[model samples]
Structure formats: C-alpha cells, structure tokens
Target: MKTPKITIDRIKKYLAEGKRFDGRKPEEFRDLEIEFGVSKKAEGSARVKLGNTEVIVGIKMGVSEPYPDSPNKGNLMVTAELLPLSSPRIEAGPPRFPAIELGRVIDRGLRESHFIDFEKLCIEPGKKVWTLFVDIYTINDDGNLLDAGGIGAVAALMNAKIPKYDEENSRVLHDEHSEENVPLTKERPISITGYKVGDKILFDPTREEEDAGETKVTVGISHGIISSMQKGNETDLDTEMFGEMIDMAEKVWQDLVTKIEKFIK
Candidate 1:
C-alpha cells in the first residue's frame, strides 16, 4: 500500500534532520536475532528477525547431473515466497516481481562471492553433482526482508549437513544425513540496504519509512568488498550519492557481521 502524502512529508522532514520516529541514527540498523533448526526435516534451516521483519530459510539437497557449462561444479537454486500471512501488501499466489528480484539478488551475491566450494559438491567429475535449494519464506514484512532473507540464507547454508547419496540408485537419501557439511568457506557475505529520502540515506527502515523513501539500494558485501548490488523503486541517483551508499553498506556490513559472527562461527 502507498504511504499517505502527509506521512511521507513528515518522514522526509525527520530524515532531513537525521532523525527518525524510532530515534535511530540514519546509519543504524534495527535489532537482529537469529534462530537455527527451524525445520527438523530440512538439511539446514534458520529463522531471522530484523526488528519486526521476519524470514525463514531452509536448505534442501539433492543429486543431479552437472550443468554443461559447469560440469565440474555443483548447482545452487534460490527461491522466495512472500506469504500473505506476512503482510497485507503481499498476496497469496504466484511470486510477484519483488519476490523474484529478492531471490536473484541473493543468488547473485552468494554465487559470485564463491562462498561455497562447488568443486567439493561434485560426486563425479562430469556426471553427478550435488544441488542445493535455498528456500526463503517471509513470516513478517515490517521492512527489509531482502537483507533478512540473505542473512537467513547464509546462516542456513552454514548450518547444513550434506545428505547421504545412494550412488547405486542415483538418488539422495533425504532421510539420512552424512557427517560432512556444505562446503562453505570462512567468508560470510552480508546484504545491507540504504534507503534514500530527501538528502538522507538510512539503513533498516521501518515499513512506514520504507514506503516514504524515494528509492533504495541493497549491497551484498563481505568484509570491505562488495559482491553484488541492486537498486529499487525507480529513483535516480548520481555517482556521488552512489558512493555514499557504498560507504554506508560497508559500515552496516561490519556492524552486522559483529552481531552474527558468533552464531556463524
């Protein structure tokens, strides 16, 4: 739903002074909480809450023939479902544009960052490779589901245990898990978003604040390096503003990694 013009004006007014209704700094994020083992049947699963926004991610593994281009590497698939129960803005039906973009942005980040050792997932040089499905479901949509889902994805992957393969039958034994875990490295990529309102850029806006913003940028970063970035809401920005957003992303990344590293490690 669109925000009321009066409310938008009030939000922009507060942003111009570097203030918000919630009394947080423009560069500050809401409280973050992560929970593991949400699904006993899934190879890995986690639930993330960013303030009031909530998302759950599950990892399911299978065996498949390698893709022609990457015959030696395994495959990663990311999908998202924005349930109507999560918010009134979401409908119960096929994925809309936002859901598709969310998955793609997260996938591009994880894929390009080389967070997973795909070579280790390959059971055979050119024939058999493990396939991982990262499924994200929104339980609430106060705001910032994209970043929350990304965090949940990484945490779930970290928690995943590879399932046993029935090589003789060319299938995966979902009921049985192997001692081996998903081949992931120490790299923990995080996604941070900056919302633009007037001349101010803010992180982790509430739903009302998000609705009031003109546009936003989401960056996938690991350490100080950026892996992927996506802009949304059809607003134009200059190079200087983009640079500022990058700076904000890096700082926010550091802040978040500090809070989540204990669980990740």
Candidate 2:
C-alpha cells in the first residue's frame, strides 16, 4: 500500500522530536510474546508475536544423504510462506521475493552463528545424516516480520528434538517414544533490525513506520559478537549513523536474548 505523504511527514516530524507515532521511544521495541510447542505434529515449534506482527515456526527432522561438500555434517533448510490472509500485500501463489528474502535472512543468522552442531547430526559419515527443516508461516503482518520470523526460527530450533534413527533398518523413527533433544551451541544468536527515517533511527518499527522509513539494517548478534549483517532498501546511511545503528542493535540484543531464553526454558 502507498503510504500517504502527510503520514510520512508526520512520522518524520515525530521522530525529529525524539518520539514515535505509537508513543514509543526511538530505541524501544513493542510488546513481545512467545509460545513454544504450538504444533503437535512438528518436532519443534514456536509462535512469536511482536506488537501486532506474529510468526510461527516448526522444525522437522529426517534422515537424508549428506551433502557433497559437507560430507560429515548434516543439513539445514529454512522456508517461509507468507500467507495472503496475513496481509493484503501478500498474494496466494508460489513463494515471492519477500518470502524468499525473509527465509534467507533467518537462515544466514542461524547458520553463521553456528547455533546447531551439524557435525553431531551426522548419523553416518558421508552417508546418512540428520536434516533439519525449519518452516515459517506468517500469521500477522503489522511490521518487522524479519525479526519476528528469526526469533520464531531460533526458538523452534531450541525446542526441537532429534528423532531416533534405526540404523539396523536405515529408517527414522518418528514416534514420541524415540526422541532426544537436539544438540546446540551454548551461545544464542538473535537478529535485531533498525529502521532509518530522515536521520532518525528506531528499533522494531511498525508497518506504517517501516513503510515510511528510508532504509533498514539487520544485525545478528551472538555471544556479544556480530555474526552477520544485512542492509535493505536503496537509502544510504551516513558512516556515523551506521555505527550508531550497530551500537543500538548491540544494546538491544542482550535483552532480546534474555527474553527468548526465559520463554524457551
């Protein structure tokens, strides 16, 4: 939807005054809620709500041939489906650019952070290995689906279980009686996106604010280190503004990680 010029102007005016249309501080994030094991069929699942935006992620495990390059390690795949019912902007059809981008961004954060111990997932070196599939669905699209989706994906992975593999039969046992928690690294990585609007930067922007913004930067943080970064939109941020954005992202990363840990535990 095309945002009205007046609305964009008003948002900019509010930001200049160190305020937001939603009455939040520039660095503030909206209320967040997380629920785990939302899907019984899924080996692991989580539902995350940030303000009005909501996303659900499910993790499924299976045995498959190891990749040629990573013969000793398992595989991970992330997919996102933007339901038309979630937003007017999305349409019913195959995965579009936005959905693909969302999945890639989340995948990068998880993979770069090395959150999962892929080597341990190897059922048999260079032969059969455990493959994890993370599926994400948009339930609502008020704004900032990337961060919400990323959170859902990570939370779901943390909740996931490793299905028992019957080596004798060369088959995966999907029954509830034969399952164990998946192994993961001690560090947890989280993604935080900052939106820039006419020299003003904010975290976790709403749909209207995001539509009115010029550019956004997504940073992945793990163990107090940046694992990955991605910038979106055509607008260019000044050097100083870019540094400030990174600092802001780092400041908020700890709180987000703490919140997710609390929920998943």
Candidate 3:
C-alpha cells in the first residue's frame, strides 16, 4: 500500500520530536511474545509476535549425505514465505525478492554466529548427516518481519528434538525420539533493525513508519559480538549514523536476549 505524502510527512515530523503515532518513543519497541510447540507435526515450532506483526517457524530434520567440503558437518537451510493474507503489500506466489532476502539475512545471522554445532549433527563422518530445514511463515506484517522471523526460527530450533534413527535399516524411526536436544552453541544471536527517517533513527518501526522510512539497518548480535549486518533500501548513512545504529542495536539486543532466554528455558 502506498502511503500518502501527508502521512509520510507526519511520520517524519513525529520522529523529529522522538514520538510515534502509536505514542511510542523513537527507540521503543512493540511488545514481544514467543510461544513454542505451536505445530504438532513439526519436529520443532514456534510463533513469535512483535505487537501486531507475527511469524511462525518450523524446524524439520532429515538424513542426507554430507557436503563434500564439510563432510563432518551437517547442513542447514532457511526459507520464508510472505503470505498475501498477512498484508496487502504481499502477493500470493512463489517466494519473491523480499522473502528470499529475509531468509538469507536470518540464515546469515544464525550461520555466522555458529549458533548450532553442525559437527554433532553428523550421523557418520564423510557420509550420512542431519539436514535441518527452517521454514518461516508470516502471519501478520504490521512491520519488521525480519526480526520476528529470526526470533521465531531460533525459538523453534530451541524447542526441537531429534528423532530416533535406525541406521541399520537406513530409515528414521518416526515414533521414537531422542532424549537430548539439538546441539547448539552457548551464544544466542538476535537481530535488531533500525529505520532511518530524515536524520532521525528509530527502532521496531510499524508498517506506517517503515513506509515512510528511507533506509533500514539490521544488526545481529551474539555474545556481545556482531555476527552479521544487513543494510536495506537506497540511502546514504554516514559513519556516525552507522555507529549509532550499532550502539542502539547492542542495547536492544541485551534486553531482548534476556527475554528470549527465559522463554526458551
């Protein structure tokens, strides 16, 4: 949906005063909620909501031959679908640019952080290995699907359990389950996205604010380190602005990770 020029102007005006149409401060984020085991069929599943924006992620595991270069490690794939029902801006079709970009950004955040111990996923060295597939679905698009989807994916993986395998029969025993959890690293990665409007920067922008914003920066943090970063839209951000964005991202991530840990635990 195209936002009227007047609305854009109003948003920019409000940002100048550190206020939002929803009465939130420029740096304030919407309420966040995470629920696990939302899907019975999925090995692991979670639904996350950031105010009105919502995303669901499912994790499935399968056995496959290991990659030639990384024969000792398993593989992970992430995919996203922005359902038309979620918002008018999204269309019903195969995954498009937005969907692919969202998936890749989230994938990079997790993979680069080494969040999962891929070596533990190998069923046999240089042979059979576990492949994890993360599927993300957007249920609502009030705004900031990237953060919501990333959180949902991580939560789903945390809630997942490995299924029992019958190596001799070369089959997965669906009815059996492993008592251990998936191998994961100590660091927990979270993404924080900042939107630039005029000369002001804001966090957790609503759909309206996003429509008015000119640029976006998404920073992924893990163990007090930046694992990855992605910039979106066409806009020039000076070094000072970039530094400010990362500082804000780090502060936000500190708070968010605490909440996520409590929920996952």
Candidate 4:
C-alpha cells in the first residue's frame, strides 16, 4: 500500500502549525459507533467502530474445575487475533508480535481492574468454576484496535449469559427446560485509549495518524479509577504529558463507560 505522502505531510504541517490534520481541536474524539449482539451465534458479542477502525469481540463461557491454588475463583482468558485479510500489511500465520501485544494489553486492563470477579464465578467451591474466554478479532485494522477491542470485549462479557451447570452430572445443563442463565454482576471495568501525536492528544486516531504517531499509549479505567496502563511502539512522552493524558483519559473513560453500560441493560 502506498503511504499517502500528502496525508503524512498534511498532518505534519498541522502539527507544525499547532493543529490537527482532521480539523478537530486538540483533546477531541472521533465519532464512535458501537453495537452489541453483532454475532447471532455467539453467546454474547460486540462490535466497535472508531472512525474507520473496526474491531469485534465475542465471549464464550463454560464450566471447568477450579484451579487448586484458586479453588474458589473462576478463570478469565483473553485472546486477540489480527486477521491478515483485514489489512494488506498484515500476513497470514500464527499471530505476530502486534497480535500478541494486543492480547496482553487487554488482559492487563481487565485483570488489573478486577473486572471478572472470579470469586463470584465459583459454582461449587473447589470443584467447579465459571471460565470466561474473551476473543477479539480485528476485522479491519483502521487504527486504535486496542480501544475498540477492549471496549467490545468488556461489553460482550457484560451481556454474556452463562448456562447452568450440573456438578453431579459433571456437565453443563443446556436443556431448555432445565438450564439456568446467569448474568455478570454490576462491578465491571471499562477502558479508553488515547493517542498523542505531536503536541495534541486525541481520543481515537485514524489509520493514517496512527501510522505517523510518535508514541501510543493505552489506558484502562474502571469505575472512574485508573486501573492499568500500557505504552507501545514509540515513546517520547514526558512526565507532564503522561499526567495530562491520564486526566484526559479519566474523563473520556467515563463517557465511554456510560455508553457501554447501556448495552448491558
């Protein structure tokens, strides 16, 4: 793919002029669109679009024996895949470094926030537990997949319904007449990632700006508190910048949380 020289130059010029290429003011966010239940077959799923970037997240849950060390808690697993077919630059194969990095980042966000509430997932104390597996797929690598994927995954998990377990039978009770459904509790985490380019910090960067970014940072905020942080690809930020970004992220996170909460209901 030919990198748009004009696009790069335009953004660069904007930076030089103390402006942004997209004409939005500094600290502005792109138009966002989110939907739950995008996948009909999955127990729960969500799709998030930020500008041209798009990501889809799905959650599948099952019953399993609790680990010896954490007999009373459940398990939460997260995986991320960047489909080569989604972007020309990506190649088909085992997940490359980017895919792995994306997975780890999201995992930190959820785990650090105590979002899963594993203790509550315990079905039979040391015998059984609810395992939540969150899967994220990049259908389009426009930009900001981390934020989109993170939000999508959390939203999907919030809406997921667990099937009843029959510990005596050592199986899940999926029979329509006998199966029971469970919903996640109210204490869940939400995240929003902001990108800093030049002197401006933006809510969600488009593909072009992302490619030109000097540094990228992902922040996870849960219930109005900062939970986790991950910085990747580039780094030139100073202490002041970091503090400012955190403040901006706190505000942005609240707005996103409000919207995502609606999907749960």
Off by over 4 Å in 2: 177-179
Please give the lDDT score at residue 2 for candidate 4. 45
Q: Which ten residues in a row have the lowest lDDT in candidate 1?
A: 256-265
After aligning candidate 1 to the native by TM-score, how far in Å is the CA of 18 from where it should be?
A: 0.8
What would the per-residue lDDT of candidate 3 be over residues 67-111, giving only the tens digit for each residue? 999999999999999999899888787889999989999998988
- Per-residue lDDT tens digits for candidate 1, residues 109-183, read 898787999999999978999999999999999988889999999999988999988889887888887788999
- Expressed as tens digits, the lDDT of each residue in 1-265 for candidate 4 is 7458778778767866767767866555666778887885566788887777788898777788898999999888889999986799888898888889888888888877877777888888898888888899988888778888888877777666676566778776543222233345455566566666776666677778776677877887876666778777656788788788888888877777676666555
The TM-score between candidate 3 and the true structure equals: 0.97
lDDT of 1 at 141: 94
Query: Which candidate wins on lDDT?
Result: 1
Of candidate 4, the 10-residue stretch with the lowest lDDT total is 174-183
Ranking by TM-score: 1, 3, 2, 4
Against the reference, the lDDT scores of all candidates come to 0.90, 0.88, 0.89, 0.75
Residue pairs with backbone atoms closer than 3 Å in model 4 (clashes):
none
What are the TM-scores, per candidate, against the unseen true structure? 0.97, 0.96, 0.97, 0.88
RMSD of 1: 1.0
Candidate 3 regions exceeding 4 Å error are none
Off by over 4 Å in 1: none
Angstrom error of the Cα, residue 22, model 3: value is 1.5
Lowest lDDT 10-residue stretch of candidate 2:
171-180
